[model samples]
Every structure is written in structure tokens, then in C-alpha cells.
Target: MYKHILLASDGSENAVRAAKEAVKIASCTQDSVIDVIYVVDFDKSKSDVLHSGSSEAIDIERRKKNSKVIQFLNDANVNYKTTILHGKPGPEIVKYANDKKVDLVIIGSRGLNALQEMVLGSVSHKVMKRVNCPALIVK
Candidate 1:
């Protein structure tokens, strides 16, 4: 029933799981499409600049990080497109979901400790709170 599904990925193990879930959901409908989002936060950008040899290398490394998610989607033979956004992960994901008016959002959970989550506020928590649509958090 959901025609537009948004998936937020960080290239983590949980994110790969989320990709699989997205594929499953998208497959439920004939016209469903999965929109994968990967955010490049300022901290990561800074670190990449500092450590990488060139911008081309940074781009390559970023793609490497997202390879698993892409691979899963491709192997599943699903209709999906990955968009790279530059900003805080939570806010960027929320913004995209809102602007696109997606029917559902699937994101990976990092499973942070209580104290760590309370302090840092996991991105999944933030997106779930702010997004208008139903959100599925994959652990």
C-alpha cells in the first residue's frame, strides 16, 4: 500500500538490515519505490578532508560506506534511488521525508545505551519524533 518509502542509511550493519526491510516493504506494492538517503554530517566531512588524499578519494570512500545498502537493493531487484545529503543525519532525513511526503520511513537503530542516547539523542529517535509518516526502526 505504501508507494513511497524512505530509508535512511549510515552503512552500518543495522542499515543493511534496514535496506532489506525496505526492499520487503517496497515489494508489497507493484508501484512502490524505495528512496535511500545517506547523510554526510559536518564532522565526517571534516574528517574526510583531513585524512583523505583528495575529494575524489573522499567520494570513493563514501560510496564504499554505502555499498552494502546498494548491493542489497540491487540483489533484491527493487526500484530504489540513493540521495546524498549534507547535514545532521536526523534533520536531513526528517526534511526529506517531509518534503517528499513519504508513506513510510525505515531507518537503522544504533542501539545506543540509555545514557548515550539521552546525551547524544540517536538519529533514529529524532527522525521518528519529527517525521509525519510512520517510521520503522531496524535494529
Candidate 2:
């Protein structure tokens, strides 16, 4: 029933599982499109660290994170597109979902930012509170 599925990943195991689940859900409809998003949350210190690094280093990190979801989508042969954006993960994801008018948002409960997560809770929780669509969070 989902026309557009948004899968948010950060190269985490939980995110990979979420991606796989999104793929399974999309498999039911040939016309469904899967959009994978990896947000570089500027609110986190981890992002500050990435910013301090060289541009090549930053691209390498982004590529590494994107690869996890990309590999799964490739193997599944799902019609999909990937996006890498910089912003606070929760709001950025919610905004993208709203802009795309996605039917479902699939995201991991935990991401790469452990310290900020403990202080502010997970991005998935924030996304759930913000997004208008159905959100499936994989722990």
C-alpha cells in the first residue's frame, strides 16, 4: 500500500535491518519507490569532528555510511535513490519525508552518535514525534 518508502540509515546494524525490512515491504508493489537517506546531524559533536577532518575524509565517511543501505537495495533490485544531507537528523528526515509525501518512514532506533543519543534520545524517537506518516523504527 505504500507508494513511497523512506529508509534512514547511518551504516548501523539496526539501520541495515530497517533497510532490509523496507525492501521487503516495497517488494509487494512494483511501482513503489525506496528512498534511502543518511543525515549528517550537525547538532552532534561527531559531526563537528567530521567537519574538522579533510573534505576527502568527510566524503569517505559518508560513502562508508551510504554503502550499507546501498548494497542491500542493489541486491534486492529495488527501485531506489540515495541522499546524503547535513542537518539535525530528526528535523531533516521529517522535512524530507514531508516534502516527498512519503507513505512510510523506516529508521533505526540507534545511530552512530551514542553520546548525543543518550543525552537527547534517538533520532528515530524524534522522527516519530515529528513526521506525519507511519514510522517503523527497528531497534
Candidate 3:
């Protein structure tokens, strides 16, 4: 029943798996289009002057991740538009979905334990709280 699906991929294995599943569902639906988003979390660089090396390293890594997401779509033969947003991941994803009027969101959950998740708040959880559209969180 989904007409416009928004899939968030961060180049992680879990995200790749979620993308494949989302694609399969879109294929079944026949007329649906997938919108891919990769959020570049710039918040990690706030105090970057003290850690310039780490900041630069993270920027490079983010670029590589973005490239991987694009490559994955190309390999799958999926025609999709992509966005590289600078901000916190959750807000950016939710905002993009709302802005695009997407009917559904497919996001990957790495299934981190409570302690790990507390230390690094889960993007899926934050996006779920903010977005009104139905979200399918793939573990």
C-alpha cells in the first residue's frame, strides 16, 4: 500500500540489508518509488578543534559511506534519488521524510543492547518518535 518509501542507509551491513528488503517490497508494489537518505552527523565535530585529526577522519569516513550507499543502489538497478544532509541523523531523516511526503520509512536497527544504545542514542528510535508516517525498522 506504500506509494512513496523513504529508505535510510548509512552504508552499514544492517542498512544494506534493510535497503534490499525495502527494494523487494517496492518491487512487489510495482509503482512505488524509493527515496534514499544519508545523514552526515556534523554534531560530532563540535569541539573538533581539540580533535582535528579525528574530525577529519570522520569526514572522510562519512564520504566513503555516502559513496557506498550510492553504489549499492546502482548495483541493485534501483533508480532512486539520494540526499546528503548535514545535521543530527534523526531530525534530518524525519524532516526529509516529512518534506518529501513519503508514505513509509524503512530504517535499519543494529539491535544494540540497552547500555550501548544509551551511550549512543539509536537513530531509529529518535526518528520513530518524530515522524508521523509508518516506519519499518529492520533488525
Which residue window of length 10 is worst by lDDT in model 1?
41-50
lDDT (tens digit, per residue) of candidate 1 on 1-139: 8999999999988999999888888998998989989999987878889999998998889989999999888889999988889999999999999999999999999999999999999999999999999999998
Candidate 1: lDDT of 8? 95
Tell me the spans in candidate 3 whose CA falls farther than 4 Å from its real position. Answer: 44-63
TM-scores of all models? 0.91, 0.81, 0.79
Stretch of 10 with least lDDT, candidate 3: 43-52
lDDT of each: 0.92, 0.85, 0.81
Best by lDDT: 1
TM-score quality measure for candidate 1: 0.91
Candidate 2 deviant stretches above 4 angstroms: 43-60, 111-118
Lowest summed lDDT window (length 10), candidate 2: 43-52
Enumerate clash totals for all models, in the order shown.
0, 0, 0
Better of 2 and 3 by TM-score: 2
Give the Å error, residue 112, model 3: 1.0
Tens-place lDDT per residue, model 2, 36-137, is 888887765476465757777777767776787788889989899888878888889999999988999999876547778779777888899899999998
Q: What is the model-wide C-alpha lDDT for candidate 2?
A: 0.85
